[model samples]
Target: MTPIGFVHSTRTDATDDAWDAEATTIHLDGDTFSPEALQGLDAFSHAVIVYWFDRVPPEKITTGARHPRGNESWPKVGIFAQRGKNRPNRIGVTTVRIVDVQNLSVTVEGLDAIDRTPVLDIKPYMLEFAPRGTVSQPQWSKELMSDYWRTIQSQ
Candidate 1:
């Protein structure tokens, strides 16, 4: 599938953590879409972004179970059980704060994507889309994600 837009950010390398400090702008292809596409997006507080993992190499893709971050303390889990980028589909989805939405560009805070990442789609986040029932997970998963969404505060 083709990309609807591309990310613009100072972040060039993909790190394991500290994504909440990254602020990026998603510039929709003006030639393919018009300003009306994002007209009502500003009304939303957040957006769910679907992007392609263009940087992950083919050999890195795995289907078997492995420890998260290669930490032996964490139990081995299947690819689908975790949010690693080594999955088969190589697709990434993230919910980010909508900082500003212009005609064809959307500035978002805390997007876990790098510059030039191919954005497949963007949808405004709604409260109704959240989980309805209780959410359960192992202690290891919680520890693994303890700092995944922490923002870097200025000194």
Candidate 2:
């Protein structure tokens, strides 16, 4: 598939806690595109971003038992059971509120991507598709998500 453009953000460097990173504007870079590429984009207040965890290490992909908050004694669950950075494909998705859009740059809030992370695709969030069922997340997974949100709100 052809890439219409690329995403540009202030995150030009890597960090340990990629999920806790600050929100950055996702600007469409490179060659121009038809206005249709952005049609109806402003109707939504949020977006689903698909980006590649380009900086994740290959070896860390098998973190079987990890204390998401750095606490071990807990059960050593599978990597998929946790929100750890390492994974088979190292891809991450986040929903962020749209702040503004100017030409190629679209300002948003609540993205967890690290600086310069490679964005694969972006789609406007559909409220009808949002999760509404009960969540049965593992204890560690729940805690990890809570910690990250808390950290983001504090910043």
Candidate 3:
């Protein structure tokens, strides 16, 4: 599928963690999209971004899982069991706070993707769409995510 837009951020390369602190502006393709396409999006506090890992090489894609980040402490599970970027599909998703939506661009915070990342779609984050019951996961997964969404601390 073609990208509806692309991300503009300070990050030009993907990093392992601590990317949540930066803000990114998603520039919709003017030739295909207009301001009206993002008219009501600003009202939402958060949005779900479905983006592509265009920079990841096909050879690096993982179908089976080793320890998350190669940390042996975490149990090896199927590739689907983890949220790493090296998945077979090379797709990424993140929930980001909407800073502003103006004209054909929307500025958001917390998207982990790098600059120029193709955005396949964007959806408002609604409470009704959230999981209804408690979410459970392995203890190792919890530790793995402790800093996954953390802000970068300035020295």
Best by lDDT: 1
Give each model a TM-score: 0.95, 0.77, 0.95
Cα lDDT tens digits, model 2, 1-155, are 33334455655555434443455777664465554566677888999888877777887676465655467856777767765567777877888888777666667777777666666777999978978998576665555555454444565
Superior by lDDT: candidate 2 or candidate 3? 3
Tell me the spans in candidate 1 whose CA falls farther than 4 Å from its real position: none
- Which of candidates 1 and 3 reaches a greater lDDT? 1
The per-residue C-alpha lDDT of model 2 at residue 94 equals 81
Q: Candidate 1, clashing residue pairs?
A: none
Error of 2 at 52 (Å): 0.4
lDDT of each: 0.91, 0.67, 0.90
User: lDDT tens digits, residues 60-150, model 1?
Assistant: 9989999999999999999999988878989999999999988899999888888999999999999999999999999999998888877
lDDT of 3 at 14: 86
What would the TM-score be for candidate 1 when compared with the true structure? 0.95
Residue 80 accuracy (lDDT) in model 1: 92
